[model samples]
Target: MSNSSLPEERELLRQIARGDESAYTLVFNHYSKQVFNAAMLYLKNTTPAREVVQEVFLKIWLKREAMSDVEDLTGYLFILTRNHIYDSFKKQATQLKAVDNFVQLQPDAIEDTDYRLQERQYDHLLNRAVSSLPPERKKVYIARKEGLSNEEISHKMNISIHTVKKQMQLAVQTVRSFVKQQLHI
Candidate 1:
């Protein structure tokens, strides 16, 4: 695990620590495919796998100064990628649980008149919340609701993937806050 054991990677890390984009790019190009493949093996979806690659590299770049301290670059990247995927899974599970709770709170029979009325009211509130979003955020929110991936939204909107993610995050927060206010929840 000594620096001498990975002399080339050690040099790349040193360069990256000094804010060298070329060195960072070299490390990215060398490992991105492997990272994508590893992610695909677990995620079983191209979009999420691609997102993992982006997130892992972004973390690396952001923490470049610590790169030189990493004894094994490959091991460090693997840990980062694995941690991110686990986080994604946890977030998905939490969201699904929230939706499940919301559904469970409703009457069991959809044929109930009161249930139908409540459903409509909820839908109306949600629509209003969405409509109140900024134009770009609304677009991102709608695209996601339509089952488009972030990459697809980025390409369709001609924005960077990071921007698309940011917009979607902001849109969700805004809509959630608006709905909570409207529902007094």
Candidate 2:
């Protein structure tokens, strides 16, 4: 902090730039505690604070050549520390948003699954009821289900229109009652 130590710190930065491990070690020892404490205050966790300390020191070492040009080393380190904390908070927000989206979709996913299951049950019950119909009624019911109009069914089966309508009405009533009973609706 004093101007008296600036020359000594400059020499240390020069040594670090020239791949001097001892000078790098001295720099780490001098700054690591401060960096860790700042990180801990922001992150409120020991593990992440320690990680920030290691990352800050690693960046300082990796960018040692640029360090020599930094007139205010402490200010540069503070900026780096602040940027890293901002990055951590941004990453946490993104992860939480993804989790929230997934949570919000859960009920719709459950409802779709339940709907598919109920539809399958309804189809099975309808098939059973139709299979139990008498031969003449079953024939008329099948024709209607296959998209044939009442007149078309009458012509195809060589039956009168009135008979065709009567058989279809009975078939429909039978299926409706069976479905209502089986589904408890």
Candidate 3:
């Protein structure tokens, strides 16, 4: 749709709009790495970044008719990827809130005691995990645990937001692995 797009690329888009599987495969092969790298810059993990890549491509396939009208294919894909990541973050937040609410709700006396004990054991394991983190990662993990946004952590630690996110991701993975190992799970 844009004058700047190469003739071959424009034809590729048109072919995609016409439901050409080979064209779609070409587009996927050409763009998947860019999409995945963009996702990794934010997600800081392979699984979620890979998920974003798949979801973005799936959307492109589902809405192939719109490909012809896209003025900038890369920009369109980036927007789709960014939106998906935002939705993922929002879903995670909602789930966390739901879990928090469930924890706060009163239960039968026996259930409450058992729940409390389990919670304490989990917390103790998590604390040990946190304690074992490297100093910088520990700070990032604690800041995040205290409910600081990534931006807030970045400012407080005088580091890039990307660093904050990466440190947080690594800290979480380490803590999860430690807890799992401790529980023999």
Which candidate achieves the best lDDT against the true structure? 3
Q: What lDDT does model 3 reach?
A: 0.89
lDDT of 2 by residue, 60-125 (tens): 888888877877777777778888989988999999999999999999999999999989988899
Which ranges of candidate 1 are over 4 A from the true structure?
1-7, 108-185
Q: 2 or 3, which is superior by TM-score?
A: 2
Using all chains and alpha carbons, the TM-scores for the candidates as numbered come to: 0.55, 0.83, 0.55
Model 1 score (lDDT): 0.88
The 10 consecutive residues of candidate 1 with the worst lDDT sum are 1-10
Ranking by lDDT: 3, 1, 2
lDDT of 3 by residue, 96-116 (tens): 999987776746666889999
In order, candidate lDDTs are 0.88, 0.86, 0.89
Off by over 4 Å in 2: 1-7
Clashes of 3: 0
Where's the lowest-lDDT run of ten residues in candidate 3? 1-10
Q: lDDT tens digits, residues 9-67, model 1?
A: 88989999999999999888888887888788789999989999999999999999998
Candidate 2 at 157: error in angstroms?
Answer: 2.1
User: Candidate 3: where are CA atoms >4 Å away?
Assistant: 1-7, 106-185
